[model samples]
Target chain A: MTETASLRRAARRYRLEFGGAMAAYALTVLGTSLWIDANPGSSARLPVALLPVIPVVLVVVAAVRFFRSQDELLRRRQVEALAFAFVGTALAVITYGFFETVGFPRLSAWWTWGTMAILWCVGTFVSSRRYG
Target chain B: MKNLLRVLRTERGWSQLDLAEQLGVSRQTVNALETERYDPSLPLAMRIARLFERPVESLFFLDEDAT
Candidate 1:
């Protein structure tokens, strides 16, 4: 297949997986919210809250599938990008922890994941361009 | 590292995609090899050499500065 064709195939698979994961997440969130609203402080609410982890796990699976689908060079580039994001996120989290002790606003745990995702995107762009 | 991937592909009248298909790799990988931005693994290099009917050393050379 041509380069464009291969890229399109990869993209198609990624989009399908991503869309499925997103749909699952949306459903889980909506279902859990409605359940909690109706039940009102029921003992099952905590366990129901954990139901969103199902979609989050699916998202992780989708990410792994996407990684495995890439060709070697692209895989290498992505690995490098993820490595950067991993280290950068760790450093950022550590710095934030120190700052929090010094009166900085205490951030939500989700911010770490969000920052890592953003860093992953930045790393992908930078690493791909460097290879090119 | 430097390689004659572009020259060999052109001589064979093969596009990067064609060569990549033959080598079971992506076109971006072939481009990276030709541009000297990435070096193929031993097996991949051997495959490239085999496809071009040349020795690996003949197709790829280490830059003096790369050493």
Candidate 2:
């Protein structure tokens, strides 16, 4: 096979694996949202419940594949994005801590999770803009 | 670093895609490197060297003076 053809093949394989894992996570996380909404009284519906193990497995597999065979550029880009995520998350938590230490109270763990989601999206956008 | 990736790849009758497969990168990434639109990191440089069966310094140069 020609060089170009082979490269396309590799890229297609990586995309399939990465995209499939992402779709699985999305479906599982959104699907389980209902359980939490329906049974607020039960800790069984928490986001980190045992029911979500499937997505975790999918993520782990995808992660292994991506790390083992991904392009150097894309790998570096992912690492940069992750660094941005950590910085963003840490900044949010520090701000929350300061507010609580003063007279201002904060929301519960759910709110923290919600904030994390928001910050993650923003971090991805910002990091991609700056680096990717 | 500047590299003779374009020359060596062409001499071997290898397109950017072929090198991309060996390197596990997109053809676009290979094109980018060849056109000097992007630069490859050390690990990638080493991979290319290994694939081409050339010394790292032979394929990639630190500066114009290295030649």
Candidate 3:
């Protein structure tokens, strides 16, 4: 029972789920962009913005499950990884948001992909440092 | 970290999983130690040494910087 908390095992499961969700997130963006572009006159702003929320929720859920019933060391390492990702993401988003509010061109469609790339790489580093 | 975990466990004929189970950690932790990717905290290292019936120094050695 206690052996279930192996970091590698937990990390492997999280990676698989995260990868699937990432694919869904990318497809959602591509599919929705195509639909919206085809109907440029349509008003689906709320729905369009909500599209990215799917991956966000999936990641959070996976993170929660990964930490469930674990010992403190493992739990703390997960938290450390999350903290790095969230803090890094917030800084990036706010910087971009500030630029946009000041009339800079918004990032291109592939911008969502950047978050996943950053989170995975940076989160892994943080986890390794904290847990290793 | 330099540890005699593998040696001690081998002497007792215990696999990494067996020792991990005794400590409530993952076999990955054991693997990490064997591979030197991770270093356990002092308490955990001590616990492991005790569990294997060896002195802490016999189980794990410190680098020059550790001192």
Candidate 4:
């Protein structure tokens, strides 16, 4: 198959796998939350809370597979974007941590992941423009 | 690095997309190569040379200042 066809197939597969994994994560989170709420102080609460991580692992696997499928230029772009996101997220979190020490409201650790994800998109866009 | 990619590609009457298709890369990559915004990997450079029926040295060269 042509590179274009192979790329399209990889993209489609990634979308399907990522979408399915996210759906599963959402369902697991909802189920676990409800179960915990209904049975306060249950021994299984810790395990149930961690259940969502399984689907998240699958999502990460799907992402890695998609990255591997891309050509050299695209792989370089992805590496640059990921580097940008990694560094940007670190700086942001550290800055935010300093603010929290100086009377700002404390934030959840989940915000770090959210910030990284947003920066990843921004980095990808910036890298795309750089190449174009 | 400087390359005669644009000149060679136009000489063959191939659009960026057509060349990208032939090279098995995205059109943006082809555009980057033509504009000298990106340098291709050695393998990609070899592939381009093979496709154009030219030696790699004939297709690409260092800028005079770099020599």
Q: Rank the candidates by TM-score, best first.
A: 1, 4, 2, 3
Q: What is the C-alpha RMSD of each candidate to the true structure, in Å?
A: 2.0, 5.0, 6.0, 2.4
What are the per-candidate TM-scores when only chain A is compared? Answer: 0.90, 0.54, 0.57, 0.95
Q: In terms of docking quality, how is candidate 2 classified?
A: acceptable
* Model 1 per-residue lDDT tens digits across residues B14-52: 889888878877888888888999999899999988988
**Predicted candidate 2 versus true structure: per-residue lDDT over A73-115, tens digit per residue:** 5566556666766777778888888988888877777776577
lDDT of 3 at A129: 71
Cα lDDT over the full model 1: 0.88
| Model 2 agreement with the true structure over B1-67: per-residue lDDT tens digits | 6779999999999877777878877666787678665678878888888888989888777667556
Model 3 segments more than 4 A misplaced:
A1-68, A71-73, A105-122, A125-132, B65-67
Residue-level error in angstroms, candidate 1, position B6: 0.4
The C-alpha TM-scores of every prediction are 0.92, 0.60, 0.55, 0.91
Clashing pairs for predicted structure model 3, backbone only:
none
**Predicted candidate 4 versus true structure: per-residue lDDT over A51-116, tens digit per residue:** 999999999999999999888889999999999999999999999989989899999999999999
Off by over 4 Å in 1: A1-7, B65-67
TM-score evaluated only on chain B, model 1: 0.92
Span of ten consecutive residues with least summed lDDT in model 1 chain B:
B58-67
Best by TM-score: 1
* List of clashing residue pairs for candidate 1: none
iRMSD for every model: 2.2, 4.7, 4.6, 3.4
Please compute DockQ, using alpha carbons, for every candidate against the native two-chain complex. 0.58, 0.37, 0.22, 0.45
Q: What's the residue-level lDDT of A56 in candidate 1?
A: 87
Error of 1 at B32 (Å): 1.1
